[model samples]
Target: MNQIELKSLLADRSPETPAGRIVRTLSERGSMSAAQLARLTGLAKSTVSTALSELKRSNMVVETGSESAGSVGRPATTLTLNPEAGTCIGILIGQSEIQVIVADVSHQILSDATAVIEPDYSPARGVEVVRELIDAAYANQWRSPDALLGVGIAVGGPVSPITGEVMRGGIPNWAGVNLHEMFGPMFDAPIFADNESNCSAIAEMTWGAAQGFEDFVLYTLDLGVGGAIVSGGRVLRGIAGGAGEFGHVVIDPDGPLCRCGNRGCLEVYASFREPLAAAERHVGHALRIADVVRLALDGDETCRRLIRQAGEAGGRGLGLIGSVFNPALVVVSGRLASAGALLMDPLAESFERFSLVKGRDMPDFARTLLRPSAFVDNGACMGAVGLVLRHHGQPLNLPH
Candidate 1:
């Protein structure tokens, strides 16, 4: 295989190159028909056909069976990038765990691994965790790490798209760390970095709950209440990477303190940190957020109450987002979201109660819709791979 040719095609950023665009799109969006590619890439049908023919001839693209086009007598042939062409790595430096997923050009996951760590782990420790995870993932696999096209990083907090410098919203000690400066020398390929919530939104759009929706909001009710806004098929990362930081939105001046050092922030009220602690206290031992959710599902009233109260509080925060964006859909993400209707029912009720656009006042189609995330645990990690494939937020030579 010509690793250099695949790398060159992926590295070409020029808008005039349809073949590069086709490869990137297939890598990002997975299998789709030729017409879908033309519409998505804004290229002419003839141009797409020509580019696809060349890609197929070069063995960079391959057929992935066919799907009915609804109205067609002949089935539309679905196409995807050849899995052997290359692979991508998605790294999630999360609050309590570091995860890595290796996926091929066809979006097939080759290996995945996660290592639990302290919330306040050092950046050096994070790098070590990543190295170990990557090593384990590539072991015994048929693919070679040398053909890695790129790496995508999903951090717990917001990171500057241009500088790759992490902002205040992540783990306590991780603030002020430069992602590019730290991770750039570790690999031979490009690196894409973004906050975990933004990555989760990309996962939703690319492969999960928000599929087919161009506009939506991802409301995370985890240890820290965070979210991402997807407008017109793009995540709205604000100046300084603070956009969609719903947790930092101050709801009261005299309320409890937040991790972001704000008083009465929505996160102070909506975050699952306190509830998880309470559940741990109730259980008389340490428990993960998923454990609490499982207990609630298994008819434990104490855990149920904790999750319910969290949902109500998180719903209030979701109401704040609804007033601003009035988004078409809200994909409730994070571990707390795993509670299913046990969490969503109350959260939706609170959102309906607090939102200016009352559900009763509008028609069903006109009102906002809320959907739980499809990924219970690894969405952000998967979306990290999406960053490399989509070429979204790829860091330049970011100097400290």
Candidate 2:
């Protein structure tokens, strides 16, 4: 099949056709055997076999390798979308950086690049930097931009689900900016956009910690506190595109003001921003969150204490979330999550302390499982790629 046809199949929500089902499954799950594909797509073995043959002939799918299924018979050959078919781009517009990733239909990353910019950079500057990075991505790679199927943007702030406008309360300079209009003219492919946390949740569901759970919550603790709610296998973007903005949840009416112009919001207390600053003061030098994590992991008592305190504060907010949704799983994400057990142990302890449903009161099967994100630095960007592959959030039309 051609690029347009492949895009159509991947974008099709209906799974009535075997080709569409197989394509969607492969796009979401990467490579898998025929049996696994059948199980995932809920198609009969015979039907899958027939469809595989047709797909192979059309070059829509290709054999990747073989995996020993621990059976007495021969190994099962893994199948994936043809890498030569088309590519997709995932971009991250962060507070001080822009990242771009290029991947093929088979989920193979062709290129990854990032450019650091000043905080509060303009959208025009972001576009220029992104264009440069995209050029560099394709400069040495065999893949050409002509084969791009779609573009997915992971914005640091909330984006209006309908208008693709970056909303207030995150990324101050980007607020009320039209992302679709800003980035649309740069490419011919369809553009998709979502908040970084939501994109991170998509990445988790597709390939990371929340792989099997359809209903769960993602709590991000870094320079900012944000989250995403996944219920029934879909990320919940509330009516105003503010569903999983857990950080902005008002905790105390008379508390300290937050960047979002609210008093006593969860982020003001839980986010690692203050902690990072405190750690810098203690060390008498500038330090990124990762640096603090490294020092903590290296047995720096002060750094460790700072992280632990941040975790405890974060857990209080998480406890509130648990009280409301009571989700089966909570994936701890963001840069702080890279601290591993140092961050998790205390966070879990505090969660148990503040949550209404104590773990000690419930059976093991009924307890919520909290796990750290699988990705350290790339989850949101990768999730942006997932947006294009899964066609999760499409941009609205605006006058060019």
Candidate 3:
């Protein structure tokens, strides 16, 4: 490729050129054979071959494993973007914790780390802590910071799509903080940002339970309740990027006040806080959502009952979602989902009872499939990495 063309190719973001189209396809569907790429990208076989050759020579692509030969077809070799071209960082600025994930250009995670802090830590403190964690991570790795493409932040609040500011009603301390500016100076690459639930949805759509589905809902039940909605393979960011604020949806006007300044919102009852409080009283000590789940799985009746009640409460909110989106799939996320059948059994049963469309009333193909997340924890941070591999935005800045 000529220098001009090569630079254009490197700078190009459109999925039109053979390389851009191929990269976009890989980002969406993952590794594939050349034939599959041709089919998916609708590029002629010769064009694909030429582009692949150039990409491989430029260290932008690499050969992975191969799929089994079909009944009447030869085995086809699979290819993916080269892992060495660059890396991306995903960070989850959660309510009670901050998680950081380091991943390559090809979506392979190199390291994942987390640090718990007080619930209302200031943004300045958050930046300091995250910077330290990131420094420690790179200090232990062979990868250089110069190769990083970008950073994607998934906050535990509503993020304005245009301003990248955290909206009020969630993470009060983070409101009005410009995300791009907060983490921009630490790294030399570009930064992307979104809500934590949206990041979870991206993780699910990219590599987890909702892989094949274009539309789904990610309902997270933990110390807090939240969710994201995906429609036609794109996360539904409302006018203000609060489209999937399921937890804040008002359900009762006279009920307990929610943290978001609302009364009787879904999260008021669905969140694990109530259960955790009950567990603390019962256990006579401190307890985390994960600890409760483990105890429940171990057959602690009180713990089990607490989880069941939380699931039942969550269903009331999800039932409203069912009436609105009626998605084909519902991927239950967050730490509570790790409870497996202990949580899902009751959740599914309650969902069916409260939802507008009854599962028995629909055909098997039309039923809303429910499954737990493949990630037991830190899904949002991983999804931040997903944002980079997919080239959803400009490359991230490498840490100084």
Candidate 4:
């Protein structure tokens, strides 16, 4: 089938068509057996079989060998969308960097690349850098840009769900920028957009720490402290797109000024920016957040102390989230999460101390579970890809 047909099937939200349901399910879940597809799509076995037959005949589906489902019978054959049918692009616009990833419908990553840019880079500069990166990503691959199905963008700042405009605070240069308008002309397919934290949550739900749980929270402790709330298997992008901006939450009205222009915001105290600066001074040179995390993991007391302190501060913010949502699982994300127990122990401790419901007071099953993100450097970008795969956050008036 052509790209239009494939896109139409994947983007079709109607539940009456078995073919559309099967295509969308495979796009979201990657490879699966007919039985699994039937269960996930809530279609009868005979209907799924018919749809699969039609899809295979149209070269839209392909057999991916077999996977043992740990059953007594022989392994069931798996099926996935034909990788040659179409491709998707995921771009991440970070504070000081830009990343691009290319993947097929079968969830196979073809290329992933990043470029470090100066801080406060303008939107024009960002588009240029992204174009270059995307070009380089496909330079060696056999796939052509014409096969691209859609583009998903993960912006560092909050994006209005209604307007596709970036909000002020996270990325100063990106504030008020219309992402769909900025990136639309560059592609021939539909464009999807969301803030980085929300994209990270999508990545977690699809492939990482929060894989099985529908109700959870993703708390990111990085140069900035931000998070995303997931309930009923959907990320809660608040009205005007300010929902999970935990970092901007004002904790002290009279405290120091924050980058977001708010005084004593959670990010001012919990972010790793100040700690990284301190680590740089102690080491007599500049260091990335990962460097301090590595040093702490290697038994550096100073680095360990910094991480512990940040964790404690982060936990206080997380505790507030706990009191508010009491999510079943909290996935601690960002570069600091790489420190492992050095960060998690203190964070969890602080969370227990400040939260209204103490873990000790609840049974093991009732206690909130905390885990680190599965992806360290690429979660948001990959989540951008998930946005396209799952057909989430599609821009208005976009053609199928």
What lDDT does the true structure give each of the candidates?
0.88, 0.90, 0.81, 0.90
At residue 131, give the lDDT of candidate 3. 90
Best by lDDT: 4
Model 3: per-residue lDDT, tens digit, 6-59?
A: 323434566577887876676556688999899878999999999999888876
Candidates arranged by TM-score, highest first: 2, 4, 1, 3
Find the 10 residues in a row with the least total lDDT in model 1.
391-400
Residue 77 displacement (Å), model 1: 2.2
Q: For residues 1-400, could you state the per-residue lDDT of candidate 2 as single tens digits?
A: 6778788887676767998899988998899999999998899999999999999999999999999989698999999999999888999998888999999989999999999999978889999999999999989688888988889999988788888888864675788899888998898888888889999999999889999788999999988898999998888988667889999899998999998888999999998988898999999999999999999999999999999999999999999999999999999999999999999999999999999999889999999999999877889999999988887854454232
- For candidate 3, the 10 contiguous residues with the lowest summed lDDT are 1-10
Best by TM-score: 2
lDDT of 1 at 373: 94
The list of candidate 1 runs beyond 4 A from truth reads 1-5, 8-14, 42-46, 68-74, 118-120, 281-283, 398-400
Writing each residue's lDDT as its tens digit, candidate 4 over 204-307 gives 99889998788999999998899999997778998777888898899999988998777999999999999999999989999999999988889889999999
Better of 1 and 2 by TM-score: 2
lDDT score, residue 400, model 1?
Answer: 26
- Residue pairs clashing, model 2: none
Worst 10 residues of 2 by lDDT: 391-400
* Candidate 4 global lDDT: 0.90
- For lDDT, candidate 2 versus 3, the one ahead is 2
Q: Give per-model TM-scores.
A: 0.91, 0.95, 0.90, 0.94
